[model samples]
Target: MPEPIRTFRHFRDVPDSAWRWGNFSPAEIACRGTGQLKLHPEALDKLQALRDRLGKPLIVRSAYRSPEHNRAVGGAKASKHMDGTAFDIAMANHDPAAFEATARAVGFLGFGYYPRSGFMHIDLGPARTWGERFPVRAVPFALEVPAARETLAESRTMKGAGAAGVATVGAAGVEVAQGVLAEAQGAVLPLIPYLDSLRWIFIALALAGIAVAIWARVDDWRRGMQ
Candidate 1:
């Protein structure tokens, strides 16, 4: 037996458990002008099945219009929307031909193409089609690359560069100190050898950091080319 059509004054009146379709909400199918909702379970079932098959969002433009809202919107006298069995879906994220094929497979018998408005209407009424087909797109919308989350602290090249910069500054400061200490303080003469050793260590660290930075740059370039 066919599921009986149900009506609600507002989408909020719908019980949470009664809303079984995972991809659709009662609010989405409510009358745009009045907030009233009429539900046809089999129609929604077909719609949900279509959504599941497409594996993408179905952007509903209009659905479940109240009789008054339908008339105000200049809908056909016997529009399926008043019966809660029609939906106007945006085509911005869909390829019309593929979408139509899938809609048919999911038991949507009515199709009204509004290419100028960028939406297509599908219904569970008698089989029919209307209006111009969408112009062929060179490509459907492509998924974007995920964002990178690497921070400066996590970059090995940056770490090496920081180490090198700190070492270079430390070595220069030590040299200046040695010059002043040697000329003014004969008591601290033994510290000069240790300071000389530290200067060489800093120079070595700076060179090592430069090598790491060069390696990192090359690796980045190679990966980008790939």
Candidate 2:
């Protein structure tokens, strides 16, 4: 048999209106677990503080979801909610964006503001966090490449003019050119200082060989005379 799933009660005990404004179904209720929705003790304390500071009845849309429940609800492949350390929340005033900003400032992890759903999701693991709605629209690729390249280039020419013309470029080209220049300079730098030394060494060796040959020739001539 599979390992038993985990759950919480504080989130489960919440009234139906809190989750979906009276639209919650039995399936949604049974989705996470069968208990008064509970959370990690530290998470509960911070949540209570958030409620107190916000001065409103904080609605917990989801405290914890069982693996089966998480799968049914179209949760992310790796959801913190399944571990009883994450929750989706909303307040009586229902300002999702505002709530999300405030929650993030309070050091909550994984704050997602859902304007359409009228709630903000919060997590309590790492103080590091993120915000924004899910399924964000993809950015244009053209804008991405040049933006990335600008920081890497030593210097670059901007082609095109006025508001009507635009040109594209990348960092790889500039980086390659810079690297070639660097290598060429490196190869030539060491040779410049050693040129005089090499010339002197060659001339001295030539003189030494010439002197040895002349001495041998003189000795041979004397022997011949005797």
Candidate 3:
């Protein structure tokens, strides 16, 4: 049988002094950049516990998000942030794995490691994990343009030189053309290795996206199971 969904009152009852993390405040966690913050009691409790265990300041990148704000940021349809049960914390000073471990020990069920963006997401939602610790650098397609242009110019020069003097151009022009072709090839050949690397990077990114989607589905299933 499917378990009943847990409901939370959308309000903040805890006093300011209750939040041990002096650096973080309810105002910063509020939706739409407003000072009015509403958070699930358990979420706040676990977060504070995690902060205390770490013995360091935790920078909250994002917390409670309004439905409109969530949509604008392309958040998941049933994002925990909407219910103030999620937090995206900066990973600058904190070690990702250590922070994640502390968060889990403090009862956060959802974990997302985004080393590229320098932030980790923790939430009191269905137990799930996603995202990459090492980010893939995108291949700049612009680099290829210059190499292609040089190749084209070399080909055009070869053609014009050959037509201008078939006699003198026959031997000397053929030699020069071959040299230009070699130069162009030299310019283009190096990019092949780089292009191959980019192909793998693109494939990896696609696979990562698919993995995240599958993870979300599994998390939803787990929620149902609960």
Candidate 4:
């Protein structure tokens, strides 16, 4: 015998525009740049419970992706986004561990931590977890590297000109070089102390940006292993 489809009685009386969880509006939980939404009643109920427990505003970073959108964003084949049972929340004002615990207590089982992206993924899917802690936000090191190198090069050129001892030009060049070097050092000085700790993260981000195709393949392989 076929099982009867269970219907949520509360959702029947509520309009889509009025559908909301605590601290989250229907518009906020909809897909980015689209009005489409398909939030599961149970998921919303659980999330509302979580919000009540936390007593803070929750920002929905992503929710209810279409299958095409999911694939475009490299979501898993069976991702909960397609069914509207998943959402990603911003971590700006919430403690990750506490948030995860609250979500778990409220019935979310799927978890994914994207420290590099400064967000966490939660879903009402089968019990499982993935990803690592994001202790700090990913630095814009790629952008900074070129600027630092350019400054260093300019300082070197100024120093070389000053060393040539060309009277007025030499004295002026020396002064300019000292100022440039000082400024450049000031910009890069803070990064030096944490170089060892951030080395792997920097390398990984660099490789991912430089070789997208390779990174995609490697990422797929890595996810498969997990």
lDDT of each: 0.91, 0.53, 0.67, 0.67
Per-candidate TM-score against the hidden true structure: 0.68, 0.41, 0.50, 0.52
Model 3: lDDT to the true structure: 0.67
lDDT of 1 by residue, 1-226 (tens): 9877789999999999778999999989999999999988999999999999999999999999988999999999999999999999999889998899999998999999999999999999799999998887788767668858568888867877887798788889889988987997678898999989988998898888878877877887797799
Error of 2 at 225 (Å): 99
Q: What is the C-alpha lDDT profile of model 2 across 102-206, one tens digit per residue?
A: 676665877666656766678865654454464432532122233333322332221111111211122233344444555676765555445445445545554
Rank ordering of all candidates by lDDT, starting from the highest: 1, 4, 3, 2
Could you give candidate 4's per-residue lDDT for residues 1-226 as a string of tens digits?
A: 5222222223233375556464677666665544566657777777788889988778889877766777887889998877777989888877787788899999999999998788899998799999997664344222223323335445434444433334434345445555555578577656544543344444444444445545545675786699
The regions of model 1 sitting more than 4 angstroms off are 143-226
Distance from true position, residue 74, model 4, in Å? 1.9
Q: What is the RMSD, in Å, between candidate 3 and the native fold over all Cα?
A: 22.7
Q: Rank by TM-score, descending?
A: 1, 4, 3, 2
For model 2, the stretches where C-alpha displacement exceeds 4 angstroms are 1-33, 36-38, 125-226
Q: Residue by residue across 1-226, what tens digits does model 3's lDDT show?
A: 5222233233264465545445566566777543335546677778888989988788888888877778888999998888888999997777666777788888999988888788999998699989876343353212223323335445434444434334332344444554555567566555555544554554555455555556655765786698
